[model samples]
Target: MIEVSKGIYWVGAIDWEIRDFHGYATPKGTTYNAYLIVDEKVALVDTVKEPFRDELLSRVGEIVDPAKIDYVIVNHLERDHFGSFAQVMDVAKNAKVYASGRGKKGIEEVYGERWDVTAVKTGDTLGLGKRTLRFVETPMLHWPDSMFTYVEPDRVLISSDAFGQHVAGSQRFDREADPHALMEDAKTYYANILMPFGTLIQGLLAKVPSLNLAPEIIAPDHGLIWTKPGTIIDAYGRWSKFEARDKVVIAYDTMWESTGKMAHLIARGAIDGGVEVKLFHLRKSPYSEAVTEIQDAKAFIIGSPTLNNGLFPTVGGFLYYLKGLKPKHKIATAFGSYGWMGGAVKEIVARLKEMELELAEPALDLRYPVTKQQEQECIEFGRKIAKQVKEAKQ
Candidate 1:
């Protein structure tokens, strides 16, 4: 186990083989992080997933006997963070289990009454000799039972999932990770898991200072521990506000080559209009990646061929995921080619409207193979959206 501070250690497990978390692709895998704080009465902050329970015990065992742990604090009840709760309770038999009220109920519902679990709320403090850990309820910052534990003197915030990435490696601190790689994973994590909780995050950030919880280190349940918490806190602030770069994303799926041509032509138009563009083929690109792009870009330009009088499956599925993620303050437009029916463009527009993104340009629904005029129109449509995005930026 690595010592994170004077008396605290990292006793977590790293999963180097995990390629996907639930449905979101985690090509870089992740870490199920838990902390071990040794004071007069030792406290264990969270636990790893079921499969990594052994790893966690091994790390903790290197420092102190598992049986010596006095309190086991659960910040979240999500399976990844608490799947090994049973094993922990069994090993640390004398330790008092603590969780948020909702977290306690959820844990009991999932695992039954095998262990004594105490419910805690915001402002609750658990004293351990010279050190004290304060709980801050952050419900729906991703999950209803989510919370954060602040360790005083050391100034460490054991953030459940917030400020986490999906990077699995020996580098335990954000200072050790590649800035670009860390940011990419962070953005993907936020887009896939926490984007829906933007409003809650904003509220939480505003209240942090008033609560007097300025952490020097942010130890999340996954990925690298943020040694410089201010960097991540600033990032969260900007992302929660739904800030965007001056760029356009042309996401599409083509039945033949017609819609594909339109996507490229539109991308060219956006470039000529002086804004950056990202063209993604839905079939070739993963939704996780596309969502990351949507998280930053100012405009969304979609193209999809009609199938069964509706959007193509790939495009339709993407819209569903995007809508759930709730990316905001973007301008959107649609384009597509059709044979017998031309509902793809219209359906795409409807989905964009549901997301509440501004309509930057008119839809460009065309016939079978894009003609010269339609190609030109696609370019003009791109240019129109680019201009709109630029204007929004100003």
Candidate 2:
């Protein structure tokens, strides 16, 4: 176990083989971080996945006997963070579990009240001798049962999932990883999982200051801990506000080369208009990565070929995925090429509207095998989006 503070230890398991988290890609794998605080009273904050239960217990044994654990603090009821709960309880049979109100209900619903669990709320504190664990409710920061555990005197924040990244490494702290790469992973994780909760995140960022919850070390349930808390705190502030850059992301899926050609031409136009452009062929790229690019882009253009009188399966699936993410304050439009009749562009526009993204222009559709004229029009459409993105930046 790595010591994060005087008495706080990181006893999490690193998952180097995991490549998929539900649907979100985790190419770099991830860690299920559980912190161990050994003061007068012993507390285990969170647990690893069920498969990593042995690793967790072993880590706990490095510092103290698992049976000696006095309290099991569950900051989130999500399985990734609490999957080893049953096994941990089996060993620490006398330890009591503490979680948020909704968290307590969720635990009982799943485990049937077989264990002793206490419901906590914001401002609640659990005295662990010199160090105290303070509770803060952060509902819908991805899950209804989510919350954070702040360790006093140590000034360590055991953030459940916030500021987490899907990355695995022997290094435990942010300072150990390349700053840019770490931030990129963090952005990808946030874009895929927490993008929809931007407003709630903004509220939480504001609330932290009011609660005087400043942390010298910020430990999340996944990835590396933050020794320099300001970097991640500032990043969360920007991301939660949906602050964007002068960039455009073009995502498309093509049955033939028509839509692909359009995507390339559009990207060219946007680049020419002095905006950074990221182009993704949805079939060839991960939706999680695409959303990460879109998260920072001021505008995004999506294209899909018609399939069965609707959107292409990949495009349709991506739209539903993007819709749930609820990205805001962005300009968007749809474009596509269809065979006999066109429906993909219309459907794409409808989905964009449903997402509440401002349409920079009407959805553009070209007949099968776009003519040179239509190709030029696609370029102009891209230019228009780039202009809109620049204007938004201003």
Candidate 3:
């Protein structure tokens, strides 16, 4: 166990073997962070996943007896945070559980009404001698039951999932991890998991300042603790506003070589047009990674080869995933090659429109094997997108 603050310790588990979280990829795995705040009344904030119950308890046992925990704070009721609830409550038999109103209801619904739980709201405070724990209801900051616990006098904010990364390592704080790598992991986590709730995040960020929560340290439920809270908070501010850089993202899947050729030529034009370009073959790369690149990109161009008069399976699936994310303020267009009949490009354009992305150009489609002339058209297509991206940035 590592001491995060003077008396508060990190009693969490590292899941280095997990390569995937639901559908989001976790190449470096992740950590389920739980904080143990030792004061006049010992309070254990959050718990690890069910599989890591032994590791979590072992760390807590080192500081104090598991049964001695006086209060259990449920920051979030999601399975990853609450999976070991039964085991923890079993050990800390006399500990009182405190959670957001929705969190308490969710806990009761899932585990029944056997345990003693107190429903809390925003502005609620619990005193433990020198430190005071303040609750802030942050619904849909990713989850409805999500909340943050601010430890006053210590100036630490135990954030549920906000400002978190899906990374696991021996390091316990941002200072110990490579700055660039840590931020990239945090970006990927945000793109895949929290992209749909940008507006809510903006509101939360504004609320934090007004509530006078000037946290010196921000401890999230995943990844490392943020010693420099402003770094992540600044990034979150830009992201929550859907801010974009002068970059273009091209993603496609080809049945043969036709669509692949178009993607490469388009990428070349975008590169030559003086903007950053990220190209992805959906079948070969993880969708999570492509989404991360698109998160801050000014424009997105998608290509697909028709199969049985419909979108290529990979492209269609990617669009479905992208639609759910609801990426905003992006310039998007579609292109494809078809045999006999053309329908894939139209479907792609429709989906893009459904997501409310601005269409940069009319959907481009070429027949069967793309000729030399059609290839130049693809190059021009990329150049046009690059121009749009640059113009948007200006």
What overall lDDT goes with each candidate model? 0.90, 0.92, 0.92
Worst 10 residues of 2 by lDDT: 385-394
Scanning candidate 3 in windows of ten residues, the lowest lDDT window is 385-394
Ranking by TM-score: 3, 2, 1
Candidate 1 lDDT, 1-394, residue by residue in tens: 5888889999999999999898798999999999999999999999999999999999999999999999999999888988898898899998898899998999789878777888998999999888999999999877899999999878899999999998889999988888888888888999899998889999999999787898989999999998888888888888888888999988899989899999999999999999988889999988888888888888888889998899999999999988999888888889999989579989999999988878865789998998888888988988888888888952
Q: Lowest summed lDDT over 10 consecutive residues: which window, candidate 1? A: 385-394
Q: For candidate 2, list the clashing residue pairs, or say none.
A: none
Residue 359, model 1: Cα distance from true site in angstroms: 1.3
Candidate 3 per-residue lDDT over residues 54-168, each given as its tens digit: 9999999999999999999999988788899889999999999999999999999988898889999998999988999999999887888999999999999999999999998
Task: Score candidate 2 by lDDT.
Answer: 0.92
Q: What is the lDDT of residue 339 in candidate 1?
A: 89
Off by over 4 Å in 1: none
> Cα deviation in Å at residue 263, candidate 3?
0.3
